[model samples]
Target: MATQPLIRSDHLFDTVELSKWELEQIMERAAFWEKNWRPGQAPFAGRFAANLFFEPSTRTRFSFEIAEKKLGLHVLNVNMEESSTTKGESLCDTVKTLSALGVEVVTVRHREPEAIQELLTEDTGCKIINAGAGKMAHPTQALLDLYTMKKHFGSLSGLKVAMIGDIKHSRVVRSNCWALGKFGVQVIFSGPESMRDHELEKIASYLPFEEAIREADVVMMLRVQLERHHEQLFVSAGEYFKNYGLSIERFQTMKPDAIIMHPGPVNRNVEISDELVEHPRSKIFAQKTNGVFIRMAVLERALGGVQR
Candidate 1:
């Protein structure tokens, strides 16, 4: 009888390191799994995986758990509040312990910008999937965003994307910039000047708020990170909505084919008006739906025998 081939360990850190071909494979696989995946279709049956989310989350955390369960892995959800970390045990120590105990994949969301990097270097038996690491990266989120856009437009090439709202201090922006740049997408940045980060200025052109919206094929409104939105002048929620948010007037001028997108927990009437959240053209919910399938592809890629 033929023996199964040995698989190499891999990590999905930031989409910056991903090539176009690799991205295509993931996108293709995600679509395939979305159409074909059935209940209890467990490919990684009996293998173990752990979610070590040091920071709070909702969609990303739950999506990972759902994907892990669907993949047939024994899932361990570590509550940092109750975990040994409260007893002074280090994160690396906990991860190493899990690896020793046969955990084969660890999905982590941490606040330290460099914490995930440290784990990438450690020679553990399990794969490291960076759920989100501070403002550094959120690869999985970008993947699903890409999957959503592609599913809608059929291709990302030559599409124009307006990434509005808080740009600085957004890990999602960093990952999206890296992933979307590969597909010939014209990513323009616009929002309150205070929210703009200069480091990413070179890759994306800064357009005036209105011009960016009117000309784009996809209008992706980012959530205003209230904690990080440190503007020189205090811009109140109502003022921001009128001046910068996607109001009804602005939405009226948008191209008929143009679609609205947001990585949500939306500020309702702040970043986008309440009426537009579920608007005919909004892909916000579609992005959330695509998130699950995209994660299914990512989790399977990590634990389902892909080479490093």
Candidate 2:
């Protein structure tokens, strides 16, 4: 939490690498850009960037694309299915080819947990950003989550964050826990016992759904990643809604000041009630809006070669 060291990270692969100072710096930049960055302002106008999402995405992909355009960077979105990678061209080779062909930055989301890390070792001249990785990291998402929280509450410290649902397959969970670890925030996980993992047991405690909801300052529901679950932990949507999901009855019991959040693709009536998605206290939509500003800061840092 002291002053950030006089250095910069070109690749945003993990939030654990960021200091509280650095986290605040990015949030500050995001807030400034949201209010002040006007039309026709292009800082990287002539430079080129690419979003190579090997995994499917809607929010993170579009958010980064919008941010790149706002920064004046010419953008290319690689269609993974048609890309030569399907013909055995390696991810690194494709990245190297993009760099050689004039891409200044490559934001990637691969199913491989180490795809971005492997690219870092390859020494491509272009900057790399992690959009999301399989069950691992989604740094920008975490930042925007914090940004949204701070926007509503004015601070991150001492906030009790109950991260509910899909912890086992969530890339967002690690980043949020690691980033919040730098602050005084108390983070806990609540979901089916099958959805809990042992890796973060030291950092966050697991609570029953009811206890987590009652004590939290922020209830962050995650999408139930059905696509990623290999094991048969079959609970019907109605079953999930009744127990683990945030039912309307449960919502009434939360602290009056507590807010609701979901990293999105929200399974309405499953992970959360339909009525609460747009509720006065729900920050779900705000998280999406703040995503643009957060990615603006991240793209700037990646292309700027440092945080200013």
Candidate 3:
């Protein structure tokens, strides 16, 4: 029988699906790619990849496009609004069409978590990557976040990460909890009771805002998704900041080496203070920088790069 790929799936849906060994391989490969980047190395010379994003994105979409091109793959980026999907074409039909067009890989971002998985059948020939899928999972973000932390700390075993804000709705948090657990990393959820998830509480401990910040090795703040806004989910932004935001005073209480993180498109002073976003200890930008290499590693492995 042929050996299975390191990811063991044609689609990457969530972090829980990846073993610790697989995570390690991805990080090791990312490190190698980061250090040994050459002017022209095309790992997927003859292959084709497509990015199909139904949601608006600045980082994830652009970074994936860069990774695909860096690997020397022909990339097709479809404008969801301009595409036939807007004319009532189903997602399944659209993806199958890409496969029919000779595209070998497709990275997609949609609101429903199960929507993309519906395309994963014996008949579909293209590989799928979950960029962001509703309130369930953003596996690649979790992968890049883990790679960033591992690259910084050199180990994940004793790390404590406090995930603050919008826990119930943040897919990044959902995937992070799964990835962190595999390495014995302590995961703490901190936010207003409304944003806290009861189901996730079973996997990780819930801590008060101050307590969470004080104990963390990494403080990860989440954006308040105004796009997913429902009535009464938040009050005034000023009031929310006073209670839950990472003000400069709260930042001062943190260990000097402890880093701050946020998955992009920040709400500025809402979840994190404006001043601290670029503080020396902030890994927000580093996370963005690491995202490219980590995604390159993912693209290569998903296309069947030899396991290290």
lDDT winner: 2
For model 3 the TM-score comes to 0.95
Residues 1-308 of candidate 2 have per-residue lDDT tens digits of 22222235488888998889788878877887798789998877788999999888899999999999988889999999999999999899999899999998999998887778899888787889999988899999999999999999988889999999889899899999999888889999989888888787778999988999999999999889998988767559998888788888999999999999999888899999999999999999999999999888888777663333
Tens-digit lDDT track of model 3 for 46-158: 88999999888999999999988888889999999999998999888888899999997889899987787786653567888888998889988999999889888989999
Worst 10 residues of 2 by lDDT: 1-10
TM-score for each model: 0.94, 0.95, 0.95
Could you tell me the TM-score of candidate 1? 0.94
Relative to the unseen true structure, what is the C-alpha lDDT of residue 9 in candidate 2, on a scale of 0 to 100?
44
Model 3: residues >4 Å from true position, as ranges? 1-9, 306-308
Q: Write the per-residue lDDT of candidate 1 for residues 225-270, one digit (tens) a residue.
A: 7655444433588988988899999999898899999987799889
How does each model score on lDDT? 0.86, 0.88, 0.86
